[model samples]
Structure formats: C-alpha cells, structure tokens
Target chain A: MRTPLCDRFGIEHPIFAFTPSEHVAAAVSRAGGLGVLGCVRFNDTDELERTLSWLDDNTDGKPYGVDIVMPMKVPTEGSSLDLGAMIPEEHRRFVDETLLKLGVPPLPEGEGREGVLGWLHSVARSHLDIALAHRPVLIANALGSPPVDVIEKCHEHGVAVAALAGAAKHATSHVANGVDIIVAQGYEAGGHTGEIASMVLTPDIVDAVGPDVPVLGAGGIGSGRQVAASLALGAQGVWTGSIWLGTEEYRSLSSSAGWETAFLRATSSDTVRSRVYTGKPARLLKTRWTEAWAQEGAPAPLPMPLQNLLVSDAHNRINASGDPDVVAMPVGQIVGRMNQVRPVAEVMAELVAGFDEAVAGLEKVRG
Target chain B: MRTPLCDRFGIEHPIFAFTPSEHVAAAVSRAGGLGVLGCVRFNDTDELERTLSWLDDNTDGKPYGVDIVMPMKVPTEGSSLDLGAMIPEEHRRFVDETLLKLGVPPLPEGEGREGVLGWLHSVARSHLDIALAHRPVLIANALGSPPVDVIEKCHEHGVAVAALAGAAKHATSHVANGVDIIVAQGYEAGGHTGEIASMVLTPDIVDAVGPDVPVLGAGGIGSGRQVAASLALGAQGVWTGSIWLGTEEYRSLSSSAGWETAFLRATSSDTVRSRVYTGKPARLLKTRWTEAWAQEGAPAPLPMPLQNLLVSDAHNRINASGDPDVVAMPVGQIVGRMNQVRPVAEVMAELVAGFDEAVAGLEKVRG
Candidate 1:
C-alpha cells in the first residue's frame, strides 16, 4: 500500500479518499489515507472556512486535502443571458411535475435555496479562496485543471495541486499547466468522467505525463485489490470517492438514511452515466429521478449551472423524502462492494491490509 | 507469471490469447500461453477441422483453446420471416452508400459472400461439433455459455469449458450451467462486451462465481502489468484478444496491410463500442465507415444475423479496399499500448519480464 507518494504526502498509505462530509474526511485523515473534503456543497464562503476549521481540529494535526469543482469555461458563455432564464420552461416543468408525481415534498417554509452544488455560483471562487487560506496539504479540481495562478499559489504555500483527468489528452494538458499530480478518473467513476476504464486510462495518463508527475487511478475502485491494480497500472496512489459514501461517518452527516440504503442494495449494473445530475455526464445511482430525465418526451437537460439549478431543489426533496428508491446520488460502479456501513477508519485499515495481501499474492504468482 | 491456471493448462504463463488467425494461435501455444482460436469465420466444417489438425501439428502438443460464438437465442427466432427480409432496405442501402462514399472497392467478381462472421449459420453448431473431435485443451463461448451437452461432452473428454461474461450475474449463471472457468470481460475490451469495467467486473465475477471456479480477467489487458493486476483482482489468469491483432503472426494471416496499419496508428480513444459490427454491440476502430452509420437519417442497425448479413459485405469491401482509415476490425482500448509490431515469442517474453518488474515494484512499495 505504500508508495513514494505516501512519504511525500505524510501518510501511512497511498490511499486518497474523496468525500463530501467533513467528518468522513477527518476520520480518513486520522486513520492514515489523505481525506479530501469535497467543497462543492459549501454554498456559503464562511461556512466552508468554518468546516475546514472543524476538519483541522477533528483530524488531530493529520494532513488532509480539499476538492472543488471548477470547469474550464463558465457555463454562462460570457453572454448577457440571465443564468436562470437559460433553463427552458419545459425542463423546469418536467422537474416540477416529476417531483409532484413522485410525492417528494417541497422544502419547509422559509428555507430558501439556489442551486446547492458549487460549480456556477460566485461562491465557487470563495470555496477556492477559503481552501487556499486553510491548512490543506493538497488541492484538487474535480472538473478540470485549476487556473495556473491557483497552481502557483498552492505551490507557494507548499500544497500539492492535483486535477482529475478522464483522458490522456486532459492529463497532458494538466501537466502542461503545472499540476503536481494527475488523477486519472475513468468512465466508471462518479461525477463527471470520460469514456476510458482505469485499467487503460491510468497507464495512458502515466505514460502521457511521463514518470515524473504522479498519477492517482480512480473509478470502480473500492478494495485493496483495486488499489494494487491501480499501482500495477503505474499509478502512484488511488483516488476513491464512491466507497466513502457508504461509511458510517458519511451516513451520519448531511445525507439522509435513504441515500446510504440505496448504495447498499445496488449492484455494479445499477448505476447509469447520464447528464441528469449537473448537465454533464456523470455516473449516478439509477433512481426514478435519473430515469425520468432519460424517458421520451422529457426535455434535454440544460447546460451546467442551469441544469444543477433546475434539479437541485428536486434533489433536496428526494433526499428529504426518506425514500430509498428515489434518492439521487453520484456513485461509481464499485457500490456493489460497499455492502455495509462501517467506520472510515475500518475502511482505511481494510484497504491497507488488502493491498499488502495483494502484493504478497503477486509474489506467489510471480513464481 | 505462473498461476494455478498455468499448472492446470500445462502452460508456462497464465496468459490466454484469443485470436481469429490460426497462425497466431499456433504461435501463442508454442510461446507457452494457451492460444484460443476464434471459430467465427470458419464457415466450412471440414475446413475448420483441417485448421484444427494444422494447429495440432504446429503447437508441439502444447495446450490450446477454441472460442466459438453461440448466443443462447438464435437470430431467426424460429419464425417464417426470411432472415434477408428481416433487414430493412434502408439499412442495406445505407451500407452500400457508405461504402461507395468511402471509395471502398467491392470484392473481386468471383468471390461470393454470405456474411463472413458466425452466430447465424449452421456451421456455428458444426464448429462445436468439430472442436469436440479435436485435442483442444479448453473450449470457450464468445457470446454465452455453450450448450449443456457440449459442456458435458467436454468434461467427459477431460477438457475444460470457459465462458466469457461481462457481468457478475452472467458469471454466476455460467457457473450454474457448469462452466469450468469464468472469463470476466469488461467494457474496454474489443468485440462483444458489457458496460462494466475490468477493475470492478473482475472482482464482482470472482466473488459471484466463488473461489472454487477459476476466473480469467479480460479486457484492457495487453501487457504483463495488466496480467498481474488481473490476478490481484482475484483472477487466476488473464484472457487477452486485441493485442494479438498487432502481432507479426496475426499480421501474416488473412487481414489486409491496411488493417495492420490502422491498429498501429490508433490510440485508446480511437476505438468506439458500436453495434455497427455484427448487430450486437462490439468495440471497433472509429473509421469513416462507422461514422457514416451515425449520421443523421441513418437507419438503425438491425439485430443479430440480420445486422451481420446487412453489413458483413461492407466489412468485406472495407478490408478489401486496402484503405487504412476505413478498414473494419474488432479491437480493444489496449490498441493504444500497441506501438509496434513484434513476433508472438517476443511479445510473450516481454509480458513475463514485465510481470516480474511489476511484482518487484509492488514489493518495493510495500514499505
């Protein structure tokens, strides 16, 4: 489980866990692997800073990372078009009618909302601003390479900057932009990903960026054996996101019980890669919500911020409905491996042990 | 690398090579991996038996396998509708127009054709019939599990029966039907495949089929490193196909010079998993011919034998035209890793050496 990255990142193992819950992040950091707190849900800048402060205190001086979603180009294409108006009436009506049909109740009175996810709003800038101000050991861009200035700023603060790439070309582009690490996120990965498998994508990106820059393999990875396979694919570490969703720490966080239950029952074939989540192709748990968007006569999802804007409220309703069948959550195919909820520390330990056993098994096979 | 499968199959390595060419199959067996000859294109039973006899003479008594395509359901559906009538006229015209547009020449006047691939003809059954008479060490089904009688006969002859599965459920079902080995083939593989990737699918199938039945991890595997990763995922061996297409032995077989050149110049991204091949979804090179089928107003590809009947001639024409960009062939994402052409012996040597290096690296990282 150990790699050169384990020494550089000040971690006991080469596992890097990506999770949205600050508690899960803290627990993972405390356990050994680097816990990257996803900053996409922090709508308020002060809230993000306060969450980081909480992670700082809870992790007991252990190093952690932060991940923010930032696509290369803004969804509002520099035009004066009102962002809210960008969504067609039919799309809005489809969301509204679907929520009504599914019996998902509206938010409680006085709970105002504006697209809960963070890619489009001005707060996205603040998420990075606050992340930089915090004591994070690394920064990662979920959508693409962060700005060159951001890379330079992180380097100045001695914080490593990694960007997720779904293709070798994207990895090369990230390398050119001075990214310290490249996470080769594959087609089976949650959130936005391209059409390549980790088995093929990891080696492709590793060769594309050369041996100097470290690559973390992502997608369909939830076991120590997969971590070992990632290394065999020439990755220095593994960047995992989906498995953490089922951890007890994460279940006790913001998400409802329904979200975790759906993950436990689902198999590898259950997830679908559709643009229903954020108007970008992402692998999400196949629910009535995603299926509605794919049905005939359903309006096409709007681009980026508008799509997130249109469905985030409905998402809030579904997650709040306490129904496991209709909950919407981004997850990888490895959900099949997440059979039960356990502590993040246990998950981390199992990963390390699995990797050691896999390595020993490799030696036996090398006879 | 030596795995239990190596001992069982009487080979030096755990590599299972799948190739349609007899020469490539012979070379792989001679090089110590179990060579699996694809019997899809063998329309003549006597000719197939003669090819098997030649393989028997050439392999130096080394163990080899045979792969035949036999979907559980026949394409004709036992209906009165003529198989020719099943393919819409629009589809036939589209293929003809696309080939003409691409300047792909027709086959030589005297060379007749009736869909050059398998899965639709009586020869498909005869393929298994003839194989049972041969000395093949193993028999595999490309599409699904072979008939129970076939499995029974193979077991009686002390020959193993393997079935390729793209999902865990399929593997369990294969095991239930008495397959001795389960091959978990992932999405990034060439020809027929499912949506799941090897990283997730391999482990899923291994657990689904249980440790008692040995599983062979397939797809996105071309080198020794991938082979090691397959074992780490709990597979006893790795079944490889597309990489053999680039071997010197394969190039010297029936394919055109144009076909060989396309495999050399392409990257992983250059392949597309499209149903344009044999009606069912199979990964193929992204060429002008495939693109033509995706254009607006293009007819949807027919299913099964109808689809194969509709365009096998187009495939024949494309390969016969000697155009590198438009030649049609089944391939996997590992085509990107195939930078040069080499003999089967050299490729086999590199795989063994690479497996050793990967294993050593794994031990080094276990700090």
Candidate 2:
C-alpha cells in the first residue's frame, strides 16, 4: 500500500482528497490519506481562517493541506475590472428582474456586498497566508502554477508546494518554477481544465518532468481501480475532487443542494463545458442556465472576472432557489458515476480494496 | 514552424494525415506533410499488399506511412469463448434473420470466406511488411501498441515506429517497449479510444513520457490554432484523422449511402462511441443500426472478428440499398468542423495558414 507519494507526504496512502469543506479534509487526513481544503467557497479571509482553525482542532494533528486558485494567466495588465467594474449595470438589472420574476428577493442593498467575490487573488493569498499559520503539510494551487512568491513562501516555511497542470507544458512550468508536487489533472477533472484526457496526460507529465518531480494524477478518479491505473501510468499518487462531493462530508454543505444531488444522480452524458461558471469554459452538470446561455440570442460571456462577476448573483439566486437545472455547480463528467453518499473514510478503504482487486485482475491476465 | 518532428519527418509541417484511401495519403504526402494510410478496411494479406503497393507508387517518393489496428486488450482469449463466445446464438440468429428480412443477399459461399475482423493483425502485418520493404520513413499502429515483433521489425528497418495511445500509460508502454514516436490520441479521435477526453490526454502523455519522446497530438485538431496549441502543450506534431474525410480525394470514393447526410455533414455532437463497429466501442456517426443495437431488447454484439464478420456483409447490403441510416462510418467529433470539400493539397495549405494565424493571435496577446 505504501508508495513514493505516501513516503513524501508522510501518509499511509498517497490519495489526496480535495473538498470545499474543512471537515472533509480533516476527516480524510485522519483516515490516513491527506485532504486539501478547497478555497473557492470561502467568502473571505476570515471565513478561511475559521475553517483552518476548525480543521486544526478536529484533525488531531493529522497532516492536511490547502488548495487555492492561482491561474497562470491573470488579468495582470489592461483595465481589468476588480470584480465590481466587471459587473455591468445592465447585467445586474437583468438578474434582479429575473430573480424578482422568480419571487426571490435580492440581498438587501449593502448586506450581501460585504463578502461577495472580492479580489480572488487577494482572497486566495490571504487564505494561503492564514493557512500557513496552521500545521498544513502542503499548499496546492489549483487551475495553474502557483505564484513565485507563494511557492517561495511555502518553501521558506518548509511546506511543500503542489500545483495543478492540465498539460505537460504546465507541468514543466511548475517544475521550472519550483513546485514540489504536480497534480496532472485531466479534462475529466472538475473545474477549469484545458482539454486533455487523463490517460494521455498523466504519463506524459511524468515523462516530461522526468523521474525527479512526483505527479499526483487528478480527474475522474473515483475507485481504487482508477487509482491503480494512475499509479501504473507512473503518477506517484491520485488527487480526487468530484468523489468527495458525493461523500457524507460534502453532503452536509448547503451548496450540495438539489442541483448537485441531480448532478450526482445523473450519468456521464449529463455534464457540459460552458462559460457559465467563472467565465472560463469548465465542465459542470448541464443545466438550464448553461442551455439558456448556449442559445443564439444570449450575450457572449466575458473572460475571467468580468464573466464571473456578470453571473455571480444569478448563480447565487439559482442555488438559493433549489433549481437543479439553473445552479452552476462545478463538477466533472465523473459525477454521473457518483450515485450514493458514502463516508470519506469508507470511500478511501474501498479505493484501496478496489485498487488491489484491479491489480489482481491485471495480474491474472499477466500470468 | 520548426520542431524536431518537422525536421525528422522531412515535411514543411509536422501534421500526419490519416486516411483510409490511399489516394488521400499520397496527396497529403505530395502536399508536403506525411500521409498515413489506415489499413483497417484491408481485410486480408492480398488487399493490404495491393493497397501498400498503390500507395508506394503514388506517393512519388514523398514520405508516407501505414496505420494498422492492433488493440491493447483482446476481449476473447484462446479458449472458453470469453466475451465473444458468450455472445448468444440467438443474437447471431437475429442478425441473420434481420439481413434476410431486409432482402439482402449474403456473400456467395467461399467467395470471401475469411472472417472480416480476425485477419486485422495478419493483414496489418502484411501491410507493415510491405511498407517496410518499400522503405517508408514511418509506420503507425492504431488503437494500441504495435505487436512487439512489429516494433522490432520497424526498428530493424530504420523506420520510425508510432503507436496511438489514448492515455499516458499506453504512451509510456510504447516508449518503454521501444516506440520512437507516440500519437497521443484523445477521445474525440476517430476509432477506438478509452473514455478520457483529448485536452486532458495530450498534456498527460506529454508529461509522462518527457520531451525525449516527441508526441503527435491527435483528436479534435481541425484547425491551425489547435495544432499550435498542441505544439504549445509539448506535442511535436499533430495527427489529424477526421479533417480529411470531406476532402475531394475522400469524396471520390464516397459510394456508401447507408449513413445520413447529417452524419456526413459536420457537427461535433454527431458522433457517438458504441460497440456497433468491430465489437469494440468506437466513435462513429449515430445511425439506425447503432440505435437498434442499443434498444431495450437489443442483443449484445459479438466481439471483434465475429461482430465485424457479422456486419461487413450487412454494410454491403445497406450501401447497395442506398439507405444512409443503416451505414456505420468511423468518425470523430471534429467531423462537424470538416464541412467544406476541398483538395487535400488545399486542406494542407489551409492548415498551415491556420496555424500561422493562431500563432499570430497568441503573439498579439503576448505583446
């Protein structure tokens, strides 16, 4: 059961669980594998700090990590709107009108504005800085390579820097830029991914990086068989995201509402990549919102902060309304394979057992 | 514009054209790119030999290659029938009865008695042997790794050995087992592919294998921008299959009428992977016959040789009947983008032009 990843991460297994909830992360770490808390859902720095504290109190000193979004291509130059400027007056009016028609009230003027998507980079960095205060063994940058400062800071603190890459070029960039671990994410992975299947992506990343830097295979990994396949492909470990959403820890989150339940219930055919969430084309359960945006008459969404700002309120309204067909919940096509709410610890156990069984199946043929 | 692939393959570009028709392959080679003849349709030694000879004569000394189907896993083994044997007698009877009811006469007994799919490897080997004899610069094995002997023979002849890998692990196997180049094919690629999508697959393969083994990116690469992106992601070249189907060279042999014009017409969603072709799930245009196999009471098709044998005659019947709904044509999702009918040379020119434009687009952003 031990692997290079387990040895490096000092865990029983190299399986790294990714989740929006700190509880899930704590639970997974306690169960022997590492869990990285997702930073996307945290409304502010304070919220992230509280989550870290909770994780610290609960994990009994088991090692866990923090996952943040630091896209390689940022709106560094040009008059990139700072969340507020990106949201058009017309777009806000449209959302208000639509929500009013749907009988949902807008957040009372200044009330909800306090914790809205303010400065994504700042928020992520703030979370990272605060997380550094905790006993996290790792810090993962999702969507792209981590910033040089972040990587340097993590290394300075003796914490490992992990970065997610959808392609070998990105992995090369991560390696060159000093990432200790690379999450070779496939397109079958949830969230923002460039097009590349895991099977083709994993081994290439490993080869491109040579034997020095270890890669954690992410995307569409649910079972132990998949884990075994990842390792067989040369990845030192597997990083999982969608699998956690179907687990008991994630089920407790309110965001795991009607839409996600439906997404978790559907088959692989149900997911679609649309610019409905975060302005980037990402795979999510196909919903009426995405379908509506796909129509000819709909406005072409802007990039990054603009597009994300344009639809942030609409996404909130949809989630609040419990409309499965309208909510923008990030997920991969693998969500279809997730049917039941299993415990994370039990899921980890099954993954190990499943991996053994898969290896056995292959060994039978090999013999 | 300059990559090791272009230098090694002796082409103006690193695009390798995949075509079922020898004429198309010859034309692509003449137009300054490598043209690879797909050998799946050549069912026997004689047919493959004749096709290879024709390609040799027509290529005009321009570099060209031959691609053959050699799957990584066989559903049936030597004994106990496996999946193929488990295919019920009733299902075979149903296919026979359906053909009879459709008023299609069977092939004359002993006229073309060799099983349709069983001879693929042997037939492909004959083609490879012929290609090597003619001193082709390259030879490709589609679906999976080429047989160990095939790899050794190609190496002995100083011919570059290329294998299509749908995942990074498969790519690693090819590299480790001594393949010179890898075609990192995505799910959007035509023919047999595992479930991983291309965007994820390409990068993973690139990373796993390292830059030492140059990868030819495949799947959904119809335009120059995609080719540029492939290069950007660490692929040395692009292997395009579906883009050439609508070219004038291909249209000349378009005698099949058992498929819909829409299936022939381009749309990304037109193709689906079903077990209707070669008993292995492959992406193809959806047709009534495919639907029939998936209907509520449909019988499971026999694996490979048997299923291919069962349908070859039926395809002839459907073609003769001029019903497009019943025809099974291998295609990829990129077929939708291949709308215009043009000369193969013209297509090559457009691709290079498109690549230049894409590079320009990126440069503009960079500036």
Candidate 3:
C-alpha cells in the first residue's frame, strides 16, 4: 500500500478518507491512512476550532487534513445573512412548498440552525483561517482551485494545498496556481463535481499536471479494488468520502442523521446528481427531496450560495425529522457497496487487503 | 504490452481498435492489434460479407473481429419497416425542421443513403449472421449483453463474444450470459453509454464480474498513458474507437465522409452526451447540430430505435453536406487529443511506446 504519496504525506497507506465527522477523521488517521475533515458543515469559526481541537487531541499524533468548499468564483458576495437575502423569493417558496407537501415537520421550539454557510466565500475564508490555526498537515479545496494567496498561505504554514479537479484543464490550472495535490474527482463523487468520470479524469489530470504533482483519484471508490484501480489510473492515492459516511465512527457521531439504514439499502443506481443541496451538481442518494426538485415544472435551482442558503434550513429540518424518504445526504454511487456499518479501522483494513488482492490479480494478468 | 487477452486473441499488443472503415480495420489487424470492423454501417448481409471479405483479403493472415449494435432490448418489434412506421409524424417533422434550420443540404439527386439501421434488432441479427459466416476471431455487441443464442452461436464458431457495459450490474449480466470479454465503457465514451465514468466503471465492473472475466477499459482513452491507466484499473486490454477516426488509413477509406478535419479541430471539452443521435446517451462532438437540439424549445428525443429511425435520413443529409460544424460524429472526449493524423501503424507504434513509458513511470512512483 506504500507509494510516494504515502511517504510524502507521512501516512502508512495511501488511502485518504474525507468526512464531515471529527470522530471518523481522527479514527482514519489513527488507523494509518490520512483522514480529511470536511469543513462545509462547520458554520462558524468557534465550531470549526472545537472540531480541530477534538481531532488534534484524538488522533494520537497521526497526520490528517481539512477540506473546505472554496470555489474560484462564488455566485454572490456578502455576509451569510445578505446571501440569504439574495435567494429569490420564488426559490424559497418552492423549497417551502415542496417540503410542506412532503409532510416535513418544523424543528422543535428554539432549535434554530446556525453555522458559517460553508459555500459562502467569506465563510470559506474563515474556514481556511481556522484550519491554518490548527495542526492539519494539508488543506483541500472541494469545488475548484484555491485562490493563489490561499495556496501561498498554506505553503507558508508548511501545509500542502489540494484542489479537487474534475477535468484535465482544471488540474493544470490548479498546478499552475501552486496546488500541491490535485484530487481528480469524477461525476460519481459526492458534493460538487464535473461531467467527467474518475477513471478518465485521474489519468487525464495526472498527464496534464505531469508526474511531479500528486494526483488523488476520487468518486465511486469504496473498496480496496477501487483503490488499486485509482493507483492504476496514475493516482498517487484514492480520495474517498461516501465510504466513511457508513462507517461505525460516523454513525456514532452526535451529528449522525440516522441515514445509515437508507445508505445500506441503496444500490449503485440509487444516487443522482442533483443541485437541491448547493446549487451545484453533486451526487446524492435519490430521495423525495431530490425527486421533487427534479419534477417537471419544478423551480430551477439557484446557483451556489443562494441555493445553499435556501436549502440550508430545509436540509436541517429533513435530517432532524429523520424521514428516510426526504432526508437529503450527499453520497456517491459507491453507496451501493456500503452494505454494512463497520468501524473506521475495519474499513481501512479491508481497503488495504482488497487493494493487495487486486494488485496481485493484475500481476497474474501481466504475467 | 503482452497480456492473457492478447494471447487469447493472438494479437501482438492488447489494443483493440474499432472502426467502421474496412481499410482502417484491416490496417490495424495488419499492424499487430485486433482490428474490429463495425458492422452497423453495413445495411445488409451482402454489404457486411463484402466488407469482411475485403478485410480478409487485406490483412494477410492476421485475425480481425466484428462489432455490431445488438442492444438486449429494442424500442419496437417487427421488421425495420414496422419500426419506421412506429416513428411519429411530429418526431419526423422535428428532425426535418432541425436539419432544415441547420442548412444541412440533402444528398445529390438520385443518390440515396444506404446502411443497416444499426438500432434495428432484425438488422443486427442479420449482421451477426453475416459476421459469423466469415472468420472473425471475435464478435462484440456494441450495447448491452449479447443474447444467449448470440453468445452460444459465437462460441459455436470459436469466436469470442464481447459486450460493452457501463455499470457493474450490466457487466455482471454480460458475464452471466457467457460473454468472453466485457468492455467497461465510461460516460466519456462515444456511441451509447451510461452516466458512470471509465475510471469508476472499469474497476467497478472488473470487481463485480471477478478476475476470470477479462475486462477491457474503454472511453476517453487515446494515449499510451491512458492505456497504462486502463491496465492499472484491472482491464486486460484497452478498447479504443475515437482515436481510430483520425488515422490516415481511415481518412483514405472510400467510405470516409470527410469528418477527419472536424475531429482534429475539436478539444476534449468539445464533446457531450446527448440523445439526439440514437435516443440513448452517447458522446458526440459539440457542434451546431447538437447545440440546436439542446435549445429550450427543442423536442425531447424519442426512445432507442425510434430516435434512430427519425434521425437516419437527417444524419445522411448532414454527413453529405460535409459541413464540419453540423456533422453528428460519435466521438469520445479524447477527440481533443487527436490533433494530428497519422498512419495506423504509426499510431499503433506510439501507443505501444507510450504504454511502456507509462508503465515505467508507474514503477518510479511505486519505488
């Protein structure tokens, strides 16, 4: 499992797990693979700082990274409140009507949702600032290439900056902007993604950026065989996100939305790229919410921060309601493989073992 | 470049080139790789037999194969004329209007378009019968799993049956149906394809169907590095199509429609998956014709053979016009990399060299 990327990142294996839960992140790092904490769920600097502190205290000195949603250009610019205001009234009404029609109940009294809407540029910068204050070994931008200054600032901190690129051109631009790592995310990946698939995107990005920069293959990757395939595609490692969501560590997290059962029941065809969450194309488990948004005559989703703002409350409500039919969760097509909930350590072990078997099989074919 | 698949097919390299032109197909077979003659363009059994004869005469003693569009399911039943009758007048009118708006001139007076309407099940069966009569070493179904009788018939002729699958389940079904080779195609592939990208689909299918079933990686593969990546993804060989379009041998073919210039000028991003061609998701060059169908008021494409029937006449007109911007050529995203035209032998040599370099590069990364 050891490759140049593993040695470069000081991790025992090249498997990089991306998750929103601090517990899963620390657990993955403790298990010898790099665990990247997704910062999009952190709505404020204080919450993010607490999460980082928790990770630092729990990982037993193993290296981990932080992932933030920082696109090259955002649809709107202002405070979270101002961005909320920019969301069209019709869009807001549509969200409300759709949820009401779905029989989604309101939150308990005084249980208002609050956080640094991660898609907002201001919030993303705040996340970067808080992440820099922590001891993370790397910082990854989810949507696109990080701004030049962000990359420079990370370099100054002796922390590497990784950007998710869905195309070769995007990877080339990331490398030109001094990005240390390029995560070639395919259309099957959760969160924002491009039309390109990971199989082609990984090699395409690796070729575009040359061999000097490390490329991590992401999207629809759950098993060790997939990890082996990623390495075969010229990726230094595999960047996995959806696989962690079904792990025991993630399930035990306080923020767990109780959608593990839904994930367990999903097939590869259960996922769809819908813009209901962030006004961007993201693969998610097909649910009533996604279906409603896709219905004919449904209001078109607003771009970026506006859509995020409009749906932020609805997302919270849906999760809080624990309605399996309407709970919106970002997941990849690999959700089909997450049939059971296992400890993060066990998942890591299986990934390594599967990778070994796949490699051994390929070796036999080569012979 | 030697693998078990190459030995099974008795080819020098693991590259399988699929082309509609007999000249290009024969050239590839003569160049040490298995050249698969696409039989979709052959309207009748006589034409297919003649093309196969031409290939047999030109390739010396080298082995070649045949590729036909035999989807497991057809939109309509009965003969080709019955399927043609099922096409609605509105759909026919839309196609005529769309082509008229694009200024796609009809073929010269008394010059009628000819070819097997590949989507027709009857036509495909006739193609299969013709191909089996010849001595093709392999028979590849372009869509879905080949019928049990089709696979059994191929086995009877000592011809390996290969089918293209875009998902793990599709591959599994193909293997269960006794397909000898599973061509795991990604979204970036030309012709009909699914939403999964090659990066994920190849590995997913490879894992699902197990090691005994040899998987050939397809879609967005043009360079030696891509071939290396395909091997890494657990594919025994790489199945390529769009790359062959730019070869000098194809350009010199008597059947060449002069679309080589369009392919050479296109970039990777210049391709999109649209249903305009065959009522199925297929990657095609983004041209005025595709853009026209994408407009807001454009009619939704019909299903399968119906769409094929409606557009067959329009397609003939567009190709006859030789207007590069309106030609509906099925191509992969890798068309961007086909910037120069070269002899099939030269292209084959570069692929082998590029694959060797890529393997050596991966070895460096492993060290």
Residues A69-114, candidate 1, lDDT per residue (tens digit)?
A: 8766544432213666667888888888998887788888876466
RMSD after CA superposition, every candidate: 1.9, 16.8, 2.7
lDDT of 1 by residue, B144-185 (tens): 787777788889988899999999988888888899999899
Clashing pairs in 3: A43-A115, A43-A116, A199-B199, B43-B115, B43-B116
Error of model 2, residue A217, in angstroms? 0.9
Go through the candidates in order and give each one's DockQ: 0.83, 0.05, 0.41
Off by over 4 Å in 2: A73-82, A93-119, B1-188, B191-367
| B84-125 per-residue lDDT for model 3 (tens digits) | 787888777877888888898777898766424766787888
Q: Rank the models by DockQ, top first.
A: 1, 3, 2
First chain of candidate 2, TM-score: 0.92
Better of 1 and 2 by lDDT: 1
Residue-level lDDT of model 3, residues A63-160, one tens digit each, is 99999888776445877776777778888788889989999988899986763378777788999999899899999998778888888999999999
lDDT for B316 (candidate 2) = 65
lDDT of 1: 0.86
- Candidate 1 — which pairs collide? none
Instruction: Pick out the ten consecutive residues of candidate 2 chain A with the lowest summed lDDT.
Output: A358-367
